[model samples]
Target: MTVAEGVRPEVDARSLSDADVLAIRADFPILADEGLVYLDTGATSQKPRAVLDAERQYLEHENAAVHRGAHRLAAEATERFEDARATVAGFIGADEDEVCWTGNATGALNTIAYAIGNASAGRGGREADRFRLGPGDEIVTTELEHHANLIPWQELAARTGATLRFVPIDDSGALRMAEAARIIGPATRIVAFSHVSNVLGGVLPVDELVALARDAGALTVLDACQSVPHLPFDVRALGVDFAAFSGHKMLGPTGIGALYGRRELLNALPPFLHGGSMITTVTMERAEYLPAPQRFEAGTQPVAQAVGLAAAVRYLEGIGMARVAAHEAQLGARLAKGIAAIDGVRLLGPAPGEPRIGLASFVVEGVHAHDVGQFLDDRGIAVRVGHHCTQPLHRRLGITASTRASAGVYTTRQEIDLLLDGVRDAVGFFGVRA
Candidate 1:
């Protein structure tokens, strides 16, 4: 296992009070609200002034269709769009050609899943054979998957006659690797899972899981929506077949996200979305598709959103991912520890101090998660309270729903404390405790 260097040995995600954090928070104008404890970054992060300004500048000055026209506005817009691609590509450790655009992480994931199904049906051009699915093939994921990762596979399995299987979750709400080893054997054609669990807060043991899937000759897909913005992600180093993540969840504008596939693999995979920009030529008889990323990015694309996302990438780079991750780790550990101390509270992930991201999902005994969230909301403490789109994980964890608090660069310890305090009051107010 490759443990990242410079990970502070002691600090939890909330422990960073350094000048660097102060400066980092200052760049995000929304952080000026000292009273509002925003702990919903896992759902969507708050935007920084730089990203907002970049989007505004593009709309006010260089708005035009990209990759289609030869006019002055098109030239400038094309330059900015491609430059934005370069910026995002560098941020995630991928070549520009390996990254494809989508509306959101859900869209990126569904695009890949649907494309694979299309390929299975002999619809994905020359690359169709590589991803062909049938009754003999098994597609594997985990019980911890968010519905975005889970449902698409389910639908694809139904479409292609492939058997859909999943790695089981233990009592602690984690993918049981032992069960995974048994499920992803020779018949397995693809193994997809989250890099970080949205409900569990556990970082999946990727290298070990990847090794098993690779040995079985299966392609590997990763959902990086929960990991990339919160931590440093290197797609090449991670050695996955494909990956997907959203822009808005990381403080970028909504309606844009990215999908990354290895260059060779992408070249061999059929284009998922088809339209004007995705094709080289078309006739009444047949259409020849473009290659790799361009083949995947259909239509005019989300130019301003891409620009905003690039600015968000630059903003994150300026603060440094290592620092951002360190800060989150500290907060996560502290949040886990503090929550554990309260009676009748059950955490829905790895235990305290286990490797985790800056996200946590837990339930207050007898208090419906929605009620807990509403109680917290009364104090201006915004948090996501529900099944968290992982009904399968909740079912495995023996619960129906959970309240989650996911942190980000702008999140603070004092703010987390407010959440903790709110949870205590919520338990009493909801009569979850006697």
Candidate 2:
């Protein structure tokens, strides 16, 4: 199933073979190392050769400041940068003008949060009033959010006189929709949440939540760092006013991410970072700004990283996102079942046989997460340990930390089996009664 250039393969998700999976693994150089079982893709993915080459070629041949100079190199660089934007926009079902580049997803999220805060302080004139928040207003999120998603809203609430609220999660780590209905009401001005839980691997009901927010006359913000890589996502279809995702988590470079916003809203929002490349007319006193994306992207951008991210999108497109989702779902079931069979292991997120992405987090009885991680590492299996940047969720689950194993397109069933084997060994090594 070798993908043709500029052509997406028509692949049946359920029909993918071990040979097909193994063939795709060759495109990632890190997978070639037999001693390493890289299963921490929920944190960040390994870059494929296509993505690496795209970035390297841009840096070596077309390195120049985009949208600034009148030289040939500058023209080429600008063209490539805008082309990358278009690629990312098309990938997420958004217009090119709606996508804004930032340092990372956290940066993108902060850009939106701070811009709204500025609006509350009377920035961007009357058009920005839609984003304004005060004492009577409320912001809604979830307890399952990563720190990046949680902290920004907390600060936003503090800056404004608005109150911050969260939807509680059930014992099974699923969002309590009934509680959400009660929390999100007339006073709610903004609804922010993750499309997928990074620690628990639980998929959220975006459509239902978006509808609730829409009915409440609230703006919706989606944290798509986990979903964008593993799922078939369309921001427009999801009906979120703003969505943020990181390039590094999706097989591209670090220090680059994108925010997808409604063009009208973006144009109305105040600029976050100010300096060069975002001005329309500058004078000694005040500077006029550009439109939507250019308005938000104030400084020099991540040129090579954007190119690599575009290449990564093309790679995923070649594989077909539906197939990618299906592949991960299949692996998720195996992982869930394997973990459930272990005596002392308590799997988080949805119960066994329930739908989830290809990841699992667990706590082993009488053994700390660090011990579990070390045992796995000794057996040449790489897994993520600690709170996974969701300390609040861990606290809710009545644990301080957890061990997580996340799969990527390059992951194999053998690697998952090894993880299970290592966990069983760790339980016995710790002399747990169970």
Candidate 3:
């Protein structure tokens, strides 16, 4: 059962032998095919061969329904599944029981929102009454939120009779945290926002925001969908009440994500979906649900995807998270500087660029975003183009869409140079001026 689990290897990335990096990249078959420069890690990362193999090995050798049968294969499957959960929990600095699997980050966020609504309808236990609210209560978010993060809270507010308030971003599209005190005050029941803005790449002052919400006795939710895969994240240390993210973004298979919540809060909240496997016992009139995670996971789980995600976490651990963050910082700084030098490119998120990631959304003056994307695509540079599911932020920024070039640890300086030259060419093709 001891398959070299539960540890992040301790080695400075700079001090690592060249062979180490080569071996790491070699484990990813997709990296061997160098036809494309993937600047869309914010959407999803390329999976390593190790992760794919882990999934295949599980499906081939240990396939079974987890935690139900007395058979040996079932036990093996359940152990691996729970081990994957433990791996994910450790990566995020949470207890294994605190993590619940959902279809994706979108599913996790919606599950939380729907659970809150259920609690408001007198479904959750006594401790959940604090989360239940009517008029005068508020759910606070940021203008720079992804739809996965924003829509759920919007629905929660809609159903609970609570008002939805948000911290507006400045002209540069960064969260105006200086005005956080003014925007988030009494009556703010929940303050959920993205740890890193998907469009801006700016890291919000999460610790400060969590502190504010903690003091206000409000629940705090953080969308780590963009941050967890690329940065160091300790959910407990961050003091966020709940954190949600997708596996695909971390180089794992799709249809798998995790939601971390405080045990007490989760035990009190109701399940978003109810059916087989979540209940302890059921009568014709009433039924009792399992605690926390089991209560949340109601149907057949994504066992193979969990294994892939565990493998992805191991991949990240072998590389070291600090190294990933440092690597991304270098690339992000380079891209930001280059984009700034461009005549007509208007950047989204933070302009001055402080503590940011590789996510950079920019508008090519007078050119449509689709055209920019097509130009980049023709050059084998894959980027995300459009409103980026942050339509409100786009509206506030006075743009319909923008071209986003996000980065990952595997992204190289040569690829960035390609994007730089490609963007200039697109600008020329469109005959745009600053």
Candidate 4:
């Protein structure tokens, strides 16, 4: 548990013990509450003490309008804000200028989608022509996408007169890459997909999909909300044109997220919002804007939240991402196997033995998902139910809703067993027929 200076820890990620997890859990105050078994990290994670302390420290001592004044407090606030930006950029292997702050991952995705829409309207002149779309052009995505990744593209396509298509999922709820190859052809202008499915917890083949988009001369957008927290992510290594992720999902504060774009592409795209800070010059009839990160971040920024996110980034780095991925993978396999063994329970996404994160969504025959959630809740086990903001994916899987239980760094095998026990009791209580 002691990390050495200037040396990355070499602990075996898959061999993390229950004591190791429990020790980590001690850093989060909420986890100390009795009778609380939190298993819904896919929605949002519990914040660690470090992140909370950072935010509180910033608010108490460095509270000021960043980049808007020349006072001492303002300078300190601006330095802290930009320092946070640098920390987050390093975490994702991106440049500080390439990272644009937004309200959340949904806002980040919408910024990209709206910027492209602006380009289609001839806003950025020749530099933005690459992003333009019109009749006969297609935007490709996958059916496994969460609604945040889906709706913006749908709106963009509607605005630009482009067709929106998706690669369908197979019977196992996995994306059919063959269909992707057929759909992402010469006519495709852009391709967007999730690095890891929020509902399914299955990691998609990002390299293959990015290659397909590249070969077709289309822009790539990665929804990295799920992957950034659970995997060893490098945005530069992934080579996508743009990516989006949230702070709250990674043990940071809410109301803050980042959109990472390639510098050249970001320079070409028009601003999604207009206000006080983003502008370079302005007149009664004309206005010019600043470059990338600043261009997208209009008005006041989330100063304290950014500082908190940087602390979260440092905390994860202290533990090492390799270990986080390995621990989650081990627990994911355990959850999948245990769920599959239950009668009248249908687990969604990749079958047992498949590579997945620590999450499982399932339906209980003869019992609604809400009822199952309530049953678990009564037993002091927390889980998410319903469509999980993935109505299309659920419809494709032939269900209206499902119950989801997800884990994080602090989760242990004993907690997984409790969840399984809760599921079994719920099934028996409902008197489900064989």
Per-prediction TM-score? 0.95, 0.98, 0.95, 0.98
Error of 3 at 389 (Å): 0.5
Error of 4 at 303 (Å): 0.5
lDDT score for residue 315 of model 2: 91
* Better candidate by lDDT, 2 or 4: 4
lDDT of 1 by residue, 44-142 (tens): 998888889899999999999988889999999999999999999998889998898889999988988988888898886665788989998999999
**Over the stretch 1-434, how does candidate 3's per-residue lDDT look in tens digits?**
11113225675555223344445556667878778888998888988877888999999999999989999999999999999999999999999899999999999899889999999989877877877888999899988898888888888888889999999888877667778888788888899998998888989889889988887888999999988998889987899999999999998999999999999989999898999889999999989999989999998999999999999899888778887788787778778888878999886666535667877779999899999999999988999999999899899999999899998767776778899899999888899888
Worst 10 residues of 1 by lDDT: 1-10
In candidate 3, stretches whose alpha carbon ends up further than 4 angstroms from where it belongs are 1-8, 13-23
Q: Where in model 2 is the C-alpha error above 4 Å?
A: 1-7
Q: Which residue window of length 10 is worst by lDDT in model 3?
A: 1-10
Write down the TM-score for model 1: 0.95
Mark the regions of model 4 whose C-alpha exceeds 4 Å error after superposition.
1-14
lDDT of 2 by residue, 232-283 (tens): 8898789999999999999889989999999999999999888899999999
lDDT score, candidate 4: 0.92
Model 4 earns a TM-score of 0.98
The regions of model 1 sitting more than 4 angstroms off are: 1-15
lDDT of 4 by residue, 185-222 (tens): 99998999999998888999999999999999999999
